[model samples]
Target: MARESDEVRSGTLPQATGGRRIAWAAVPEAVTAGIERLLGARVVGAVSQPGGFSEGLAARVRLASGGGAFVKAASTLTAPAVAAFHRREIAISRRLPRTVPAPRLLDAYDDGDWVALIFEEIPGRLPAQPWRRDELERVLTAVTDMVRALTPSPVDGALLGGPRLGGWAALANSAGIESGVVKKLEALSPWAARHLDELAALEESAAPALAGQTLLHGDLYPFNILLTAQDVFVVDWPHAWVGAGHCDVVTLLASVSLSGMDPQPIAESHPLTHDLDPAQIDAVLATHSGFLLRIAASAGAEADRHLVDMMVALGLASLRWLRDRL
Candidate 1:
């Protein structure tokens, strides 16, 4: 029998449970009223969507005019980080090429403390867990298409760099093995503790390997992807960044590995990574693993336990995958 954490490691548990969400009705009346004015229709009904780690509003709202739209709103007073993410998403969504599969941003509202965005609601469901091969293929194809469309990113100005790729190096240099992070790593995996130096070196060398002109959906987990009968749509732009195209592919494959499938073959054969140096791929895996570990370690006391568990599982999966490659 497999352990419960094993189910998490394979991507099943988190799919069965989702993050807590703020109900549409729970949003401030003034905020909803403002949203209605922008939508050009009165909101008649609303159903909150789930699956991400934020406690912000994410819902499909019905209009008196019989149309519907997706809404995401957060209060800077309560969730400053989430509000900041919404602000970034608003900026990036405006600049996305028309060809990208993301839903178009219809309207936005920001009044210093509250942020809201309305998007053309996509008609689709999340990709199935245990990942049916056909659906995964469709999503992968869509990801490749998105990468191509986003190359030489259309957005301008200072996009966030992939600094998380340096997590291991930072851990290694911080206060030696007695550091809180080292203690956390040892608690997670003795193997990680034993190989700390090597992992740090691999992650430190990842900077050059990660450089490129492509914009990445930095968080490409299953929750951020939606599948329709004929196409796949990627959503959630809060973490978008410009980097090597393979970085997104690598992140997706790491999530895929949680389905008890071998992601190495796909990683090796995928067009984005197929011709790249094998060592560069290793560096990416190390960087990603370190990144996950760091996030899990630093998760706040108020953090959702389920999401923290998912992060730990995915981090372990990335480490196992990296070990196999080594």
Candidate 2:
């Protein structure tokens, strides 16, 4: 018998598992009908993607006609503002550069109360947790290769972060003001409570310094990256932005560190960040981690039990990293 992949053996692939994802069987009739109409085939079965913190329905669905597509659907009940991001993603993905490694958008569905999106399936594996150096290098290299296309981002539509791509200020400002948010932050780590004010300021300062036209994949964690033999596909565009180069690298750096890998050298070794100021990189780290902490602090952020657990784990880790880095 052949040996199993380490991800199977170690069970440490950085995927979003254990969330309260709505079953495809339970999705609204109109939503299911819409997906069927888009593909011209009835959905026979669905295998949910086990990553990320969204409570929406994300799965690879098999059609009656032997076809498949990655489908994600959300409603106000499952997620609050994420449905808007799904809509935003569809619009932006359609206009992304072809050379970029994102999957193609096949169709979109909206029945007033629910929204769904369909995309070409990405057949690949999540990068190993603790990140294998070779795989980490491969993704970093891919970012460098695609920079020419990613820069001068084809899409100009405003994303969640606005022009400067700075949304963490709101989260930072919530500290001390929101008693509930404070309790959660203190529970995760006292350090977060200690320096949240400064973290907020640092995030605000970094926003203006983020000067570039590149389409930044604001959410670049391992869960959003799909690695196939031929390519590395970056998925999830709801949080994308048109901002400074190597910002994704900064996001990925925090992700790597959270997984127990030391990505400090990646910052200097990767061509994407080779010439960028270290202070700017630090700013990214500080704010990104703070944002994660803010999410972890928020009550009822997601309905999925596992997704919330994943957020809490990563959120605390990100906060700890910020406390140590700053």
Candidate 3:
């Protein structure tokens, strides 16, 4: 039932069994050929992978003569946003010493309608199942440490684009909400509604605080982090901005809960995350819930609605676990 609910909320669930393959319009063949030629190799294989969080084409590209590269290409549909994001990533990478492991920016091209960037491939298996406490601790700790070390320079508004708060505010004021999905969210229990209200408030309150401006990964979740035998590298920097550090922290804690891990024990145990008291975690869940709701306000309204419901429920489920401690 919960899974079904999530499907409805994210708009990704409740679909027919047989679905079409996820893809983008064909990338001009010359793009791949140009990359191979630039690298002094022959193009081998270029298969597209559907990227979540951002609209782009991620290809597993190999060279006839040598190694492989992962190429992310965004069309006019997403180029302006992707270009700004890429610039932020390049700045962050430049700041770090050579030892700090991250994807090396290989090449970037702006072809008007299409903008593409390439990186040397980092190879590893995704976590096959849910992470255990130890793995969660290691991964999350690494993420926090990485964010902590970076002193984000002042971002030129014209360069990195708009404020993080703009994203939420714009979504809130938008004219459309599918009536069918709005009914589902409205039908949710008072507990869910109450939690959503608090979350909306938290997001509004946190928006101003981001004015302080620190560099944040913008999007740091399990799927975005790649773990290799040698090191952990974070990818997808489109959302990177000078914002509140806690935005990054809270986003991560909420993500851990979404991944089906209890946020209590780990939040209590990890020194890095220990600052997130029960109340703070509740607020984070609320903020995170609002985030999913906005994203699903479109065609995936059902799925986003379900995610908001689940997040509210999950936040409450953790409440009991939090009570005795207080």
Task: Please report the candidate that would top lDDT against the real structure.
Answer: 1
RMSD of each: 3.7, 7.1, 6.2
Per-residue C-alpha lDDT of model 2 across residues 247-313, encoded as one tens digit per residue: 7877777566655665566667777776877667767766666656566567474345565555556
Model 3 Cα lDDT, one tens digit per residue, 1-326: 01112211211112111121224236677765665666568756776643233345676777887788877766665446655565556555545444344677777766556666777877854432355566565576676666566545344434454433321333334232333444444443333333333334556765444544566666565556777665677777666666555556555554454446655666666664577545554444444545444444333533333334433443333222222232
Report the number of the highest-TM-score candidate.
Answer: 1
Q: How close to the true structure is residue 148 of candidate 1, measured as C-alpha lDDT?
A: 96
TM-score quality measure for candidate 2? 0.84
Weakest 10 consecutive residues, lDDT, candidate 1? 1-10
The global Cα lDDT (0 to 1) of model 3 is 0.51
TM-score for all predictions? 0.93, 0.84, 0.71
The segments of candidate 2 whose C-alpha lies over 4 angstroms from its true place after superposition are 1-15, 77-80, 159-180, 300-305, 315-326
lDDT of 2 at 280: 76
Q: All models: lDDT? A: 0.80, 0.71, 0.51
| lDDT digits (tens) for residues 1-326 of candidate 1 | 11122222234436423466688888889999999999999999998875577667889999999999999899999989889889988989999999999989999999888899999988889888878888888888888999999988887637453435546776777574555777877787767766788889888777788888888888887888888778788998878887788888887787777787888998878888789888878877898889888777767787878878877877887777777777
lDDT of 2 at 317: 50
